[model samples]
Target: MTTITTNPFPVNHPLTFHRVAQPSPPTPFNSANSKHNTHPLTAYTYSTKHAEPKLSATSHEDQPLLFLLRQRKTEEAWLTYSQSTRLPGSTCLSRLVCQLSYQNTKEGFTRAQTIIQRLRDERQLHRLDANSLGLLAVSAVKAGHTLYATSIIKSMLRSGYLPHVKAWSAVVSRLAASGDDGPTEALRLFNSVIRRVRRVADPAIAADARPDTAAYNAVLNACANLGNTGKFLQLFDEMPEFDVKPDVLTYNIMIKLCARADRKDLLVFVLDRILDEGIDPCMTTFHSLLAAYVGFGDLETAEKMVQAMREGRRDLCRILKDSNWENSENADEVFVKLLPRSKISSDHDPPLLPKEYAPDSRIYTTLMKGYMKEGRVSDVVQMLEAMRHQRDSTSHPDHVTYTTVVSTLVKAGSMDRARQVLAEMARVGVPANRITYNILLKGYCQQLQLEKAKELVREMADDASIEPDVVSYNILIDGCILIDDSAGALAYFNEMRTRGIAPSKVSYTTLMKAFALTGQPKLAHKVFDEMLKDPRVKVDLVAWNMLVEGYSRLGLVEEAKKIIQNMKENDFYPDVATYGSLANGIALARKPGEALLLWNEVKERCGQKKVEDSSSSAPPLKPDEGLLDTLADICVRAAFFKKALEIVACMEENGIPPNKTKFTKIYVEMHSRMFTSKHASKARQDRRMERKRAAEAFKFWLGLPNSYYGSEWRLEPDDGDDYSTDSF
Candidate 1:
């Protein structure tokens, strides 16, 4: 075993724990006890097989095993019992072993055999004894390797050992599972066990319950499983008379027989008996219920059960994982079929509807939904094409499926491909749903193709077969708004209400966004009112962000605060969006202290715990990363240089570089503004500017224009007396 010492241990399973350091003899532990342990559960040690680093001599740390084994108290006892002693261990390993043995419950007794193989690899092969060997034989027999199982059994006999009656019960039970119920050969095996037990001495004979009775039950079940209804009935009739008290497994098999036979009447009959006997139906039982509901078209119930299985609400890892097919419409149904009906349930009847049971349609729709959710139009189309080839027997996909793909493509902003997919769907006789039409409408609206979008809308409305929902109307309204046609959006919103379709948050937000875009806050506020009036309308993050951003940009600080306060009242906590506005708006209003406070809050909320331990503080609000740079320029406009400098300092402290082109332009403007505001004489300023331009003039005089050189005025200069140095 690898030692468990050191900071990092490299091992797959950490259950093999050991100690790290040396100490005085192990003692009892208490809060006030000596400092000997690092953690209660943590163990560290070195490999016994290899030389390792020694523990530090200074620290007094005890090994965990010493304490666990009670070294000081039980040292002599352990030495006395050394040869016969079993090392103490946690029960965790025992539980793990039991769990490993139950890997395959339904497929036969192969579980024990599989564990033996693992044990053999782990060099623990000696763990296999008469009982385990018997289980291995049972697994082989049920796996249809009867010859191998026989060989194993013979080997047991040769070793002067055989499984007890209990082990014999397991072997006989597995043999009976192989459908070899031709005669009472199984009865002979049971009788053989009786005779052998009688021959054993009384002390050895008095072990666990007689394994012969277990063999009896196995034999009886074999008869039932073989479809010998007459024989099964005979056994059932004789079971009570034979004094065989049916165990849980025996009745479970009976329940299974009913479900497998698809004899619904017998199924229900067996269900009542199970309940009368007060037997609990596990996940396998509920799986059988799901199967029964499959042919009945109660998909909702089936889906509900499936959800329960998926969510781990039931102990179904053994039940569903082994039985249910992955990604199949009838996967849940198969699980149900394995189960027998139940009078009692683990959960209340859930209102889940399993979608259409058509495996092909269900799979196709599911993939399409996933693609739509991910905005992967291309993948959606590819999956649809494959489904079309399988089901339609044509070159292209069905219209409905194709339409779904096309609609998803449009939503994903793949307009060209969406149109292509649309053509293909139309070719395949798949009519589009409202969502499909909406995708095309939104795409056209974005491209400002009003005529095409309107045409499709009209087509949808004219068809009584197609019901236009809120999304359909919203798409058209959004298209209008995108093209700066707020009038069109307003008309569509009204048209939807008139048509008895309620406006969604999207409907209101689209109009609000349009108003904000046009710098019409009043109009936006009106839409906000309309949204508030509808109890069902809940504004999304995008809507609130738009209002906050728009109000901030206009420097309406008080109104922006009110919006934030309202959002808080509505229990909508401010995110980065609201904070950015708070920082920029306050900065723009020349309230640098307030701006600084808001900045601190943003950091405290977003970066307090983070930046304290962080390698660097918040990044300076980059023009690209944030819009607060506008507030920095506004500071220059408001003539608050000190406050603007403070903002720069904060940005720098946060590692933000304030390299503002706008601020530079404003600086130049500010200089000009200051001079002009002072009413400084232009000529007086001109004299100072003339002195500054002397060097530039000297360079210009040497590099005179070619045209000027050709000019007579430049070639023949006036008298030096007339052209003074100042004139030159």
Candidate 2:
């Protein structure tokens, strides 16, 4: 153990410098007799042999005085505590308190103890005020010393020196708002204070120590921050027990928590209590109420709340006028009487209350959202007009309002109207965001307007300075598939990857679907293989089902079967779609026996069978339309008329009445092939001839002979030339 000190004095110098390290042994810094020992062991020390040469002349006599300038640490307080008896260390104590107030806890508390000892020596310990102690406690908390802070507060309270409510509130607020263990610590401190307050015999001292509304509100806000509704309600109910009254903020907090939890009943109960107490609801109260009603989609109730808010504001204004309080400065007392605990400032004049309850843009936006949900387009337009006529700039329609309007119109398939809304958004200086443009993209895609969708993508990049995202590329790919433009879909897919936007599962699925529809099963499988090789994409059951359906569509039943087996091996279950695809493929392959076996399996799994009794009523297994139609056609083709009758019976039993026109056409085709149609009705024969003519016209449009099957349309070379970049 090497002894070291900044003061280069030998250990024999007793009063000259006291920080000499004893060669005996090291002990905990706390165990050192700080009072008698004089020099407390500090963290940083140096051996004499290793001490810097410049520090040789540094005198040990001024060590205590030199520590006063030490910027960091509690050394100055300790030095002042040990020496300098004539001079009061009030400034040093204040500086130490400031440094310790919510900073390094271990060091702060230690320094605070030294300051307390010095104050004790001066006989001024009891003279410390509530504000000074409260600040000390708060500072301790900032240093993550909650227990120490709690002890300070508890000591003050027990001594009958009730800390200022603001101090208690600040400490509670900080403790309760901390990440994990804060609320627990705050609760413990609160319980201790409450216990102490109740035990106080003197009413004046008890009142002084008792927490006020603000302190309670701070703790309540902590509960609200966590969204713990149960804890919030329990704490709220305890307020009256403590003789504390719930103010406007209390009710506001309760309302917000109830809205977030979607507890409409609790909200109503709280609102009723507020009304019974004659509490004037503030703007936040109405805002929360409106949000709850709108979320519930009870537009009528939401509208009523808006009306009530207007009436309430008007009533408040009438009371102000009837009281003859012209200016807010003179009206502060009057307003407080009318609205208890109301915060009114004397510095600035407030805006006059509106003569009528004119709803602001936020309210209108909320109402418009409700209308849009109910598909009330006309009502949304009317609200937009109302928003534009607002008397205050704060009530002006904002970007969110316009974005919502554009989205609603797009969903309603009013592309032209949606475009007009977009134009109006730009005119109002509300730039269209990616979502706004994406909505328009969807609208055009629904109409198979690919050219317009492409134009929007280009405009988003070039004009709006917004790069197209994965969703934009996904939409473009989907739009191409909708119009059977496989080449366009491929080009968009490649462009997305080239632009460093990885293709999503939806992108891959769309490409596969396009290939399947174009009589290209091989290309669809190739796409599936590529998707599996990419680690970034998580392959889902839908992707597997797409692959199975592609093979099934090509009349490759064995290949589809293999795909299903592979799905099970990979821990992916085959759903209704998998079985349906396999059955369709087998039936189309002219393997009636295999199709029958698969249908039986489907019936068993669905817990359904042929209805033995015509009148026996219970709903049948609800198969999707695609599966039902395919099975029905297969039965009709196999000439299993009884099975076809069974299909019809189940269809009717399940409330899914078969399409008579479709069944009739299948029946007629089977009949015409088996025999001459001499007995057919004239209308039926004429319809059959009309279908033949339509098929011929379709063949002509494809530029194929009557029996030709292979037809592929390639894109013009110049189509993608302009959009090529480094991504190519």
lDDT of 2 by residue, 497-529 (tens): 888877778889888888887878888889999
Q: In order, what lDDT does every prediction score?
A: 0.50, 0.62
Measure candidate 2: CA RMSD. 21.2
lDDT of 2: 0.62
Which parts of model 2 have CA positions greater than 4 angstroms off? 1-298, 305-363, 391-395, 412-414, 579-583, 608-621, 660-728
- Find the candidate with the highest TM-score and give its number: 2
Candidate 1 residues 573-672, lDDT tens each? 6776676766566655666545644545444554445455655333422222353464455555554454455556556666767765666565444422
Worst 10 residues of 2 by lDDT: 1-10
Model 1 TM-score, 2 decimals: 0.38
For lDDT, the strongest prediction is: 2
TM-scores, one per candidate: 0.38, 0.47
